[model samples]
Target chain A: MNRFLWLVRREIWEHKAIWVAPAIVIGCLVLLMLTGNVHLGPFTDMSGEAGLGVVPDDLQVKLLVIVYAGLALVVSMIMGIVGFFYSLDALYADRRDRSVLFWKSLPLSDAETVLSKFAVATVVIPMVALGASMVAQLVVAAGGSARFAIEGLPAAAMWRPEALFGGFTVTFLRCLTAMLWYAPIIGYLMLASAWAPRGPFLWAVLPAVGLWIGERVIVGSTFVGDFISSRLFGLYGVLSSRAEAGFEDGEGLEGLRNVDLVGSLRDFYASPELWFGLLAAGLLLLGAIWVRRYRDETS
Target chain B: MGELIVARGLGKSFGSTRALDDVNFRVESGRIVGLIGPNGAGKTTALKALLGLTRFEGGLSVLGLNPHLQRHRLMQDVCFIADVAVLPRWIRVSQLIDFVAAAHPRFRREICEQFLARSDVRRTSRVRELSKGMVTQLHLALVMAIDAKLLVLDEPTLGLDILMRRQFYETLLNEYFDEQRTILVTTHQVEEVEHILTDLLFIDRGRIVLDAAMDQVQEQYAQVSVRPEHLAAARSHQPIAERQGLGRTHMLFRGADRVALERLGEVGVPSVADLFVAVIQGARA
Candidate 1:
């Protein structure tokens, strides 16, 4: 376990994008909150009393939930991009640089090494993004609280800032849920990383794309497309399966408590989509470990 | 001393190209064995199989463990320095120490630090920040810190300047090697390592051309600087190889009586480099 942790740490040490992507995203989020210049057309804040209010406090909270959760999405997206590219790069880079032997020289087994990479993609990146989201929300909430007090607005008049933390809890859980949901996808990326003789990114993606197209042209149905769609977007399957309340109505002004951003996570957790995705991920990860062990281009 | 490495009839192929073929060798405790071969020879491939970095067809055991099946277990007792491989460029010196400490149970961080303390490498500097020579120093410091029984080096000092390269082996000899430890090294510059080699194996085109203890090489083989008057006599003895240089003939002989050869011309032990050339050319001929 300690050895695995160190391998994961090595991944973090090597890839700055894991932290940098979320930092940049949250930085933009905080900057928007500080100046109160968040204007998103219909979801604008109603509080002109602070100044020219473009985004509503409640909607902005939802937007904050969105941005916060969206950052989770963005972070997960960035992390997905990061993970996909990383998985492809990790196996190739070591061999290309001939550093595979260096790591191989260590006592850690190839399974442990490959598992550590999968853990980084599925576990560490999300945790870092979650931690970043939590921090960003806390700062924004605290900064908003200070600004409201200076403006002489009573605590009662302000949007409940506690919801930012609450919303981020949901976002944090959602990130975990996304990790569970996208495990197979990331697993495929990792498998391609280990197995591909060249350009693992293409190796990872082309087969899936070919499957999606081949199913359509040959089978003459969108049914195969839907499964690929659902396999990639289990979050939507969880979300659309429910009758969404406040934000789902699409009309707009709702209090901070009304933001049901990650409410579907409970339902998401119980669904077979998560488990099936995880099962596929586990198999793909095993394939990756097997490939890492057997594939040696050095000779 | 117990055998640290034993390989018999080892073979590996990359597509149709035989990278290693029918390779057989052994290294016992406390011996420095040089796996000498020219470019495209199986030196690197043989080392890779022993290290379990690649798979092979025949029997191979390193430190009494089947390398391919139990490589991680084998690695616990083995350390390797392949200059062709990179120590991840983004890792800091301190992080490298930390990671190794966690991954390798035998790795001693304090020993690594002690070694690093003498070098110019900074604890916080990323590997990319270090110079090429310093990276090798850092790599050496890390590998030397491991209490490994077998140290495999494949082109460990390929690109360093002469002085740094000399320092590399000198440090290995002085600081790391011991009676309990064995080293298997493959280098292009045979002269640099010939002095320290206890046994030598010459490979060509994936075949083991020669395998002998260093002393055995000196005893069984002799080079004669053929005098013009004795050129006929030396040629009649059926020298294994003859090279014409400096307006004189140099003949390499195998299993010929040393005293008899001395009567024909100046007889001396052939350098490993020259011997390698002779064996390779001889095989081709």
Candidate 2:
């Protein structure tokens, strides 16, 4: 376990993007908040509908949740891209620089090395993104509250501890579920990173694209395409579908309040796709370890 | 001394090109064995096989463990510097030390720090920021601190200038080597390592042409600067290799009677470089 920690630390040292990307996103979000350019369209629309033009306490809670989600969304999206490129480069970078020879000289095994990078992608990157987004959320909340105070509106409406706690919990759960859902893709990227002689990103994408096209042209079906889409965007699809279902017949702000983010996540956890993805990720990670162990450093 | 490494019929091939062919050798503890070979002569291939960085066919063991099957375990007591400047360019010197200290149970951090303190490598500088010589110094510091039983080096000083190369071997000999440890090094710069190597294994085209201790090489091989009058007599002894230089015919002989060779002219032990050339050419012939 101690060795494992050092290996992860080594990954962070080599790939600064893991932390830097999320930090940049947080900085941008904070800057946008400070500049007064953050357009809370839903908050403005709902405030206009309230009696006496005061945002209702319940509507304020809903708007605060939206604010948290929006901030978290932007940071997590950037983190997602960072994680993708990180996994592609993790195993490949050392080989490209002929540093695998140096790394392999130590007592650490290939399995430990590969798994450390995997943990950084699946666990460390998400946690960093979550933490960065939380900071961004706090700044946005404070800035929004100050704006409300200056405008002679009720700033206290956004400070309900229970509602704010719930918002944080949903964001945390979303990051966790997204991590688990994307494990297989990260595994595939690592496998490509380990196996590719060069251009690991293309190696990761082109084969799947070729398989999809081949299935369409030769097999006359979209089984591969459907599977790829479901694996790639299935979590977001379920989350958005749940939101739509919750707001189907309800009125606007009330509908937003009714969206069961936690319930949707719970449903996502219970899906067969998540379990199968975890399994595939396990196998792909083992493939990465095997390749790293046996594949000679060609350079 | 215990046998630190033993290999039999060790072989590897890349497609149709065989890098190692039915190779066999053994290294005992407390020895600095130079795995001397020309370029593409499987020097690196043999080191890779021994280091567990490549797979090979045949029985090979280091410290009683099969390198390929138990590389991680073997690495606990076996260290290597694959080549100069192979350290990751992105890591700070301090982080690299922290990592080795954490990852290698046998590594002594203070020893490494002391070594670095005497050198130009700064703790905060990234490897890429350091000169090639400094990078090698840092790598050597890390390796020397590890209390390992066997150290393998493949072209460890391939690109360094003369002063750095001299310092590299001097430091290794003075601080790192002892009877409890063994080192297997491969290099084409035969003259640089000739004096420091206690044993020599001359390999050519995947085969070991000569394997002997330095003392044995000294005792068995002799060079004679044959005068013009004794050329027929030296030729009759069938010198393994001959060249004309300094107004005389210099002939190299293996296992020939030294007393009789003295009759030809001034007799002396051939340098490792001269012996290597003579042996490689003899093998080719």
Candidate 3:
């Protein structure tokens, strides 16, 4: 385990360019919080929007919630991109730098090598991103609190300034839960790195596009739209429509309408869509391992 | 007394072309065997097979472990430096050290540091910033730190100049080498390694052409430079290879009577290059 951690640390330490993508994403989030048109004062003060004169405290809280959720989504997407490269680049970098020979010369096995890459992509990188998000949110939340306190607002609302830190932590956990949902994709990228001779990114991404296109072409005779929708988002179009209805009619998290954290995790796991992704990812990874095992060093 | 490595009738092919053909070799503990071959020879393939880096049709073993079935175990006892110096260009020296220290149980940090200290390689410097010679040094330092039984280096100093090559050999000889540690070094520069080699194997066209101790090879082979008038006598002796230069005939003879050759005409010690050419041609014939 310590050796695995060292592998992750080495990857993090060696590729300084990798840090740049996440830093840029985090920087953008901070920049948005600092300069966005939304009233920062209302979010800072323990007081709700009831005193703001225009918007109700509950409504203000909902807007803030959306903003925070959007921030989390954007951050997660950035990490996906970064994490994808992290996983994919791990194996190829050795070949690129010719260090494949060096590392292979070590006592480490191919399984260990591939697994360490998976661990970094699935576990270590998310932890780093989460830590960064926590620090960034605290600074942002603290600044807002100071602003709200100076304004001396009369009535507090549903948005709790104290909960911002809690929200950050919860969001990180949610993203981590979401990563379990995407583990195979991360693994697939790794396999692609091992399998392809040139442009692994293209190798990784092109297949999804090709499959989508192939699905459309194959289904053009019977159910064209259904195939397109399923390929676009792993969920069936009708099921997604029902889920969205449930979300909108939701008291939006109050009065028996709230999506509990564990419930969300359960719902995501129960979907056949997630299982299919896992299976597809497994096959891709197996293929990649096969390529590595028999790879010609001369090439 | 156990063998550290063994290969029997190993063969590899790329499409219709055979890259390695029925090559057999072995290394026991406490010996430095030189793997000498010309360009396009199967030296790299044979080494890669031993390291489990490439797949071959026949049998290969490292420390009694089959390369295919027990590659990880074999790797634990074996180390290899490929024909090229390959290190991550973006990685800093210090970070590389930390990585190796973390990954391998046998990696010796103190030894690596000592080697690094002797040179001007900066801890913060990225690999891309270093020269080819420096890269070789870095590679050697890392591999030397691993306490493996077999150390296989393929053309380790391909791009290095004389001074750098000398320094590399010196460091390898003084710091890391021992009889208990078996080494298989492949090189085109057979002349440079003549003194250090304990045993020599000449490989050509993916086969072992000649395998002999250095002393026996010296004793069995002779270079005879005969006058133009005595050329017929030298030819009658069945020299391995012959050339005419400046009205004199130079020929390399193996298993020939040297004293008789000296009495018949001029005779001297055969250069490794002369011997290699003669051996390769002889094997082909």
Q: What TM-score do all the candidates reach, one by one?
A: 0.90, 0.97, 0.88
Kindly report which residue stretches of model 1 are placed more than 4 angstroms away from their true locations once superposed. Answer: A39-45, A48-84, A143-162, A240-263
* TM-score attained by model 2: 0.97
Q: How displaced is residue A90 in candidate 2, in Å?
A: 1.2
Candidate 1 C-alpha lDDT tens digits along B177-232: 99999999999899899888889888999998888998999999999999898988
Candidate 3, residues B135-254, lDDT tens digits: the string is: 888888888888988888888888889998788777777777887798899999887777777788889988899888878888998888787777787788888899776777788888
Model 3, span A211-254: residue lDDT tens: 76676688654354454344434422322233345556676334
Candidate 2 local lDDT, A142-237, one digit each (tens): 776676676666666556675567668767888898899999999999999999989998899999999999999999999999999988767677
The DockQ figures for the candidates are 0.70, 0.85, 0.76
Would you list the C-alpha lDDT of every candidate in the order shown?
0.78, 0.87, 0.72
Give the distance in Å from residue B222's predicted Cα in candidate 3 to where it truly belongs: 0.8
Which digits, one per residue and each the tens of the lDDT, describe model 2 over residues B232-253?
A: 9899998999999889999999
- After superposition, the stretches of candidate 3 with alpha carbons farther than 4 Å from their true spots are A29-65, A146-162, A218-247, A250-263, A279-283
Root-mean-square deviation of candidate 2: 1.5
Which one wins on TM-score?
2
Q: Which ten contiguous residues of candidate 2 chain A have the minimum total lDDT?
A: A44-53
